[model samples]
Target chain A: MRNQNTNILKATIKDIIVAFICIAIIFFTIYIVWGSEISLAISLVNKISIDTSKKVLEEVKLNSVTNKLESYPEYGTKYGTIKIDAINADLPLYYGDTLAILRNGVGQFSGGYFPGEGGTVVCMAHNSTKYLRELAKVTPGNKIIITTNYGEFTYEVFDTTIVPQTEMEALKIQNEEEMLVLYTCYPFNSIGHTTSRYITYSKLVDSKYF
Target chain B: MVKNIVSYIITMFLILFIIMIIVLNVFSNTILKKEYTIANLKTGNYYERINQNIVDGFKDYTVQSGLSDEVLEKIYSQDKLEQDINSMIESLYTGSKINIDTESIKENLLNNIEIELEKENKEIAQSEEEALTNYMEAIVEVYKNNVLYSEKVVEEIGTVLNKANNIINKAQIVIYLIPLVLVIILIVINHKQLKFLQYIGIGLLATGLFSITPKIISELKMDINNIMAINQATSNLIQTIAQDILNRFTVIGIIMIVIGIILIIIHNVKACRILEETKRSRH
Candidate 1:
């Protein structure tokens, strides 16, 4: 009876091992063949990537890139310096004229023609007493010199006039000759919005291209 | 009698648990063991994700800068933008990131400006070009690392993923085989009641179907509005993936069904043979 029990026990253990092996082989084959696909499926179900509706990402800190500008100035960027001897005005000149740009310093209107283009070069600034306020007191032949990356151009104040704010035609580019226009708000020291513009027109008397 | 009853209950629980382990192994094999991550990124959808990220970044920039939408769009066409980013990603893999010199991507993007400008017929002068280039460079700087996973993430993902796979595989194998071995020992101890193994067969069938419970629950509770709100391609891909998961479960379930039926047949045959022997001996 003892021998018979031992034999039955041994057979049972063999069968159990065989069953476990069979189960393992079946599952192993599946993992070997289809593991990645199933995992991807699970992941896809869990992921949140994109949708039709718009939602912004979390605010990330942006490290400002140190801009390495070429030697030549670009439009809307500060590229030169200006000096008005009569007003003692020395200011950094930017190419594009916008409200924000003017707040910083004098800015040239980009829509108008460029220097050496034989057209009107319009430059404007805020009417601060220190900057362009003294333009009103300037007489003809006052030296207005612009130093740029490209070259330096000196202009002589030949004329000055107050034009209406709506008179954009007064600042129109003339194709016949190169002229520089410096203008600011009227009253020389206005606190609020103004309709009249203080204009100082000058002819380009001398130019030196670097 | 009570001991026998307790033994049978334990045996049934053990069988159900083992069956569930088998189903989970299939899951572990796919999601954990396979390198589905890099492959999915390599798919066309990776580009789509990138395009979306770029659009998002630009949208954020415009909101902050007060730049006109028209001007920003005119600066760089979306297609060219995505292509440029794709090129950057491609470069990072100079056949393994061993020589992943990311500094070159900045130069590469700057160098390829001629083709982009030409495509749009934008006649920007030298000054304008300089300004635009600076703007583009600034944009690239701010978003280059933000738009995707970081360098550390990229470098370590392969090893980290495989390590997880190994651990889960070992755990699953342990859970699966331990109960199976116990049930085998129980069958030997309760030889007279081996016919009760039919209960285990039934449990296996039930567990097989239970494997797809996540899919069923998700579908039942799925909001139609949410689906409509998602992009069509993404939504479609999601459905495809869900279906694929369901199909895998169904395959395992069907296999269990076969195994369950076989177990039931074997138990019935053994019970009938014992019944015949008892009747003949009494006669």
Candidate 2:
């Protein structure tokens, strides 16, 4: 009887051990495959966006701003002609991209209004690529020269600020002074839209194309 | 008595050995790998977001400060008007106290607008030089605020990732040790079941090895990928090798478990048949 009981006990122990091993192997395999797959997918997405931006920048012509009204394209239209050179690199500037000038919510670009009009003109751009990242490195007195079809408008970087998204009034066009406002999302490599906006202010120094 | 004591000691050793195998397999496969991967991803994301927010905040501040004059002028003027109206109301109350005429309050407000307009024009004339300075100062303030915020975000992310990693490490140790403890307890209670317990221990060890092998392979693969992305060529190579070893171990563990289960079942059937035969012979 004792021998039989011992056999039963051995068999039971063997079964339990076998079951545990099976479960562990299955889980381990799954963890490895899933982790690698997710990492690869994320990297691929980031690379694609970077490549696209680089391609677009390469094809665009870099011109100087010469004319004012004649050269000013329609509002909200994206033209690839103007490039802003600041911080030793040239960034493609688009018109009607919404330029908010003030750290406060007031100055913004209106369709017919010129740069000298007393209001802030807000310009928006994507920061995922290198062009916008270059902009993030701008320091005081760094020259931002906007090259338009009509003329080349040069502005000296005077200030930089970070403000909240609720402050849209800071982008409103005000009759204060002609100011060039540049803005992009705060932080270059963030996953989602953040609470604040990055901004730089520059005064119109010269416009040769106009 | 001596035989019983010897058998019990053997039984305890066998049980303890089986438990250790089971625990080691669980610890290596599931807990450690899952925790590390999650911690790394979360920490990376947090830092990325912090950098982004700082940039975005600066953009908004510049835009708003440039445009503040236009928006504030309208709002400021309205506020000034409201203030004047309140003063007039206060004066009216005083007039009733002193017997001064209420019509004079209306006349006083009309004069205030002209004064306010002139003041606004003068301020506007002086604002060009002041605007740039003020705008620059405001931006500097915003930039400072953003820097502080980013630091806080980064610190918080670091803390969470560290805590998670620690917990997972502890869990791995506990899981790996539990089976060994159980085996020891079983051995102390039974004497004659030593060989049977050893078989069971072997099966459990096989089961644990099979279960953990695949997980270990996957984790090693992930570690390799991470190292490769970071340009750590040596680590990547080592991890790749580790991953291969884990894969083979997993397969072997699975086969062992299957064999163990078959043996256990066959043994039980044979034992049952013997019992039946004995009963028939007695009858």
Each prediction's DockQ?
0.02, 0.07
Please tell me how candidate 1 rates in CAPRI terms.
incorrect
Window of ten residues with lowest summed lDDT in model 2 chain B: B67-76
| Candidate 2 DockQ, CA atoms | 0.07
Top of the candidates by TM-score: 1
Chain B: TM-scores of all predictions: 0.59, 0.29
Best by lDDT: 1
Q: Is the docking of candidate 2 incorrect, acceptable, medium or high quality?
A: incorrect
In candidate 2 the C-alpha lDDT for residue B17 amounts to: 44
- Shift in Å, residue B135, candidate 2: 40
Which stretch of 10 consecutive residues in model 2 chain A shows the poorest summed lDDT? A99-108
Candidate 2 per-residue lDDT, tens place, A1-210, comes to 676677666766755654454455444665686968766754553343222223322222323243123334443443423345544445554444433222322222453244433345566554434335456788778776655444466778788887876787655455466567777665553322245677887777765633
